[model samples]
Target: MKQDLVVDSDEALNRKMYLVNNALDEIGFTWCHAKLFMLAGFGYSVDSQLDAIQSSVKVVVDRQFGIDFPVATQIFYVGLLVGAAFWGFSADIIGRKLAFNLSLLLAAVFRPYYWWNELVSHLLAFGAGGNIATDVTIFLEFSPAKYTWLTTFMAAFWGVGQTVAVLVAWAFVPSHLCLAGTPCPSSENRGWRYCWYTNSGIVLGLALLRLFWFDMNESPKFLVSNGRDAEAVATLHAIANKHERLCSLTLEELLDCGEVKDAHDFKTNGYTVKSVFSAAVAHVKVLFCSKKIAYLSTLIFLSWTLIGLCYSTFFNFVYIYIQLHGGNTSGSTYITYRNTSISQFVGIFGPVLAAYMVTFKRLGRRGTMAIGAIITMGILFGYTTVRTQLQDAVFASLTYFFINIYFACLCAYTPEVFPAIARATGGALGVLFSRVGGIFTPLIYYYGLKSGSSVPIWVCGAVIGFLGFIALLLPFEPTRFRSV
Candidate 1:
């Protein structure tokens, strides 16, 4: 009788894994619509930090606030540094749903007060960072193994945010704003205010949608890890029902797997700061205990650091770089925004293209990453030498395209590389280190630009290419193992 029960349980679990591999089964409602809402929310959250600063608000600060606008952007990143660690850690302990909900709430609360002081800017950035970590954590938890690649593909929405922000600026800023030097009344220079207000409204709306309409459940995997076997099985049923498919998993069958142990006692025995600290330290140590995992972790950490530096240094200053080189010769803000739109338009295709490339047998995740990085390096080098508008546009488009491909692979690969129990912790550490790199970027760009225009390009290009070779050292290729 015991043997029969074990066999039946194993069979049910196998079916579950098969369904996961086949993409949670019956794709339209569960896989498409639900995922789209999540993606939209993520895009909007990311924009609240980057799009607001670069597009209209920076201009408003220059004209009306009498503050150095660049400092506001820096302050946002500093907030991100703190938020990433906190949200990442919170997701593991408090549950993904709670962390996800609170991130958007924080973003909405702090964003309206951005120009008030640098402290608010940091707080808003904190929300942005939390949103990023929380978004990726929950989204990945719900995704089926076969479709995990979609996690990376969703980054195309990052470009969507950029394009929309540019269009908004083009529509309102140049048309309604007071002339550059001639300061004017608040009523006339309200473009930036309008931009921020609209962004905050969108964020609040998404938070409501998530809280009420979306009806997302806690992660079953997390439940199992915490020793809540019944809850894990129940959550799986909820997921299966959402997909309009039948799930045969039961609590008894789940316990038979034995991989998941009840950690309730471990969790509740001694809830103290020291215990929490010790647990965190132990989890990090596990990342390096295995030779293969240790090497892979090191490579991934280094790659994120390099990517952060390159991304912040280049994209943060793209507007100024273009304007200096003749983008503003017409003395029209429209031209600058239009060109920015073009770059984003080209970038939108990159993640999709990367997703397709990874599907090929010959060029899986590693191959795609290596090729994308190499291409980006060459494009950046060429970008520096361009003098004409056409050359600038062409090289800039190519640069963004390759960089997106690289990012799609890196972002998708990070969560997959870690064990389920440690996934959130691993991802948070990666974000923390990357933000550290970003914290240093403003200094690097300032000095590099002072040295020469080409200096920043060379520095960014070299780091990207060097990291590509280091990526080759990753111990486990996702293609070699089944999707986690």
Candidate 2:
């Protein structure tokens, strides 16, 4: 009888696993495509607004908003923080598919609203908040075991979107689009508006596609934990069909593994805020209780924060510095902006390299991260001493390269370190901390420039590099560990 029971359990586990894989594969495509569209909106709209405000034509309006820029950025950052906190918990309670669909819907609706006058900032905050929360969680959950390296590639799609935006802006809203006074030119008129409209259209279309075509399903692992053996088996069978792969287990094997019982009991009659909080508490405890996990989380969090601060600070002020040192002639400004955009495009290469290294070569997360950090420090240190335009360009390019590499490694490493229950929450918190670093970066850059010193960049680089070094000591190397 015991042997029979074990065989039945094994079969059940296989069926459930197959179903979960199928659900993840289908939803993953939708999630990635939608994210690409949403990121396009953010890239075009936010960058264009910043550009417009910097131009003389909109000086008065810009001043009003400039005074409010810090506040607006903060609002956006806080919104992301809230989204992370809310959605991370929501994924565990309400179900991943539901939270996933809702987030896309929220982003689709609000992303385009940013095109409306004076509403852009508010809409951006809302859309981005939802986008980050849902997308990050879903990506982590759906990823396959061996192909975990792909997670960062999915997230790096944001950089691709940003690059596309730069190309579009250059084509449509070229430097000649605006001029001081004289009512500006026709081409420049409402160029920013067009950018926002396009972004909105893309998001709206993706939202529609997801709403009509995507099916809702719970994660099989989640189901097993909830003691829904039959449902888990059904879901697993569906997955095997979707993937066209034969599963190895039988129901008896699954039951033998003891996945039939509820992992834990809930006191609440229904899902509530209190219930979410209790789950979050349990999740957090699991993450911290493991020394290896705690160290990994800390390292990832600090590294992301530093990367966010350095990259944002550098890009935000690059144009200003160029014009100051190279003169504000139309040709010079065009060249400067073009160069800055190219730098961003080039930055993509770093992550790509890091991805290849981690995935193909198996440098392991910690090793890759450490190498990236060292390279990043070297680049930043070189940047501070460079005075010539050519040198600036070289240093900037290298700085971005290392930063991207670091980000790629961290993106893959963070999700793998935490338990599934807290994975999204931990990822969100890391991003939130990074945004905090980003918020202060501009202020530091502004002051640094005003003071006529390179101290700020040097300080930022040193801090980040040191943190990366510290991250090297973290335990729980994901490559050797089993899934939580």
Candidate 3:
């Protein structure tokens, strides 16, 4: 009997692994989706759009909008925040696959509308909301506990997307047809309108790829929890086939384990508004219910929040500062922007560094996050003290390197702390909090510019670094512990 039990357990494990691989395949597409969506929305092409509008309709549109440039930027960001909230909740209620496909479809369909009116601007924001939320949830759900740390590398695709956006903009903008009669030697070759149309096409193509070629299996974990045993078994078999692995236990055996109910009668009758509240509440409880977990969640949250704040604050103002201090002309601002883009491209090494640390040393999530935080803090301090343009650029590049590392750590750490059931919601909560810090970053930079002081930079740096120290107190050590 004991030998039989051992054999059964081994089979169960194999089936689980199969499911995980299948999930990972689908989740991988989300990373690509997120990268493209973010790039198209906020990347270098966005700058081109603003430039075109500024040259063509600045006086008329600016007056009609009744908002200055800074305010308009804020409005755009606010739209992003609203989108995040709206779509994040929707993903939890709907299945991950549906949300995933919808986000891509919406983004692709509405992107071209940007040329017609500012309505496209709002659509872009909405699309971003769907893209990020769905991507976060699906990726977290599909990843296996053992390799969860890879989520950060997946998240870094966002940076890749941003990099591609910058490169494309560099290649196309200014050389394209001039907007508002602002002439460039290369203007004869490129047109600003072409940028929007091209991006729209790319997103639409990706959407179709997801819809037709990609298999959209429902998460078995989710299916079991919802009392869909047969469907879950089918999904498990599909997973096993995809991974080319043998699953020892049959669906009947899994049903016998008592983890899943026999009846499909498990209804949502008990689910209510209060149910949603309870779900959210339970999410917090899982994190803070244990001393170990509480310490881990707090530390990661603080670290990510501060990281978001510092990154947003610095990048928002970097172009203006570089132009004023680096002695770049208006015409060369694009070049300066491209320089930062290059810095980001080089910064991919940071994620690579994180991948190595987690895979080789098995430092786990907490240790990696702590290390990244320390490096980021040091880089920020260096950035504040540096005065020369060349030194500034170098320091900025170094900072990005560490920031990317920190981001990778954060992406891995946040989801690993939660139970599979709550993973997506928990990740979303962390992202929401981090974005709160990001939201205020622009305001902080605006004030800093007006005051002509490095105080904001220093203070922000200190706050973020301090949070990292606090993160060490969190309970769950993902490197040492497996996901529940």
Off by over 4 Å in 2: 1-71, 109-120, 130-137, 175-189, 212-216, 225-229, 248-269, 318-333, 360-362, 385-393
Higher-TM-score candidate of 1 and 3: 1
Per-residue alpha-carbon lDDT of candidate 3 for residues 42-151, written as tens digits (9 for 90 to 100) = 32123222222322222223333343444434444555555556555545544555666666565553322223435555455555544443464455454444455556
Instruction: Please list the residue runs of candidate 1 whose C-alpha ends up more than 4 Å from where it truly belongs after superposition.
Output: 1-33, 36-56, 110-117, 178-181, 184-188, 242-244, 259-272, 317-331, 448-451
Q: Compare candidates 1 and 2 on lDDT and give the better one.
A: 1
lDDT per model vs. reference: 0.64, 0.54, 0.53
Q: Pick the candidate with the highest lDDT.
A: 1
- Please provide TM-scores, in order, for all candidate models, with all chains considered together: 0.85, 0.77, 0.75
Q: List, residue by residue over 148-256, the lDDT tens digit for candidate 2.
A: 5555454455455455555545544443355445454333454544544555555556556556655545555555544555665676566556656454444555565
| lDDT tens per residue, model 1, 246-286 | 66666666566564321322445746777667656655765
What's the lDDT for residue 468 in model 1? 78
Span of 10 residues, lowest total lDDT, candidate 3: 1-10
Candidate 2 lDDT trough over 10 residues, lowest sum: 1-10
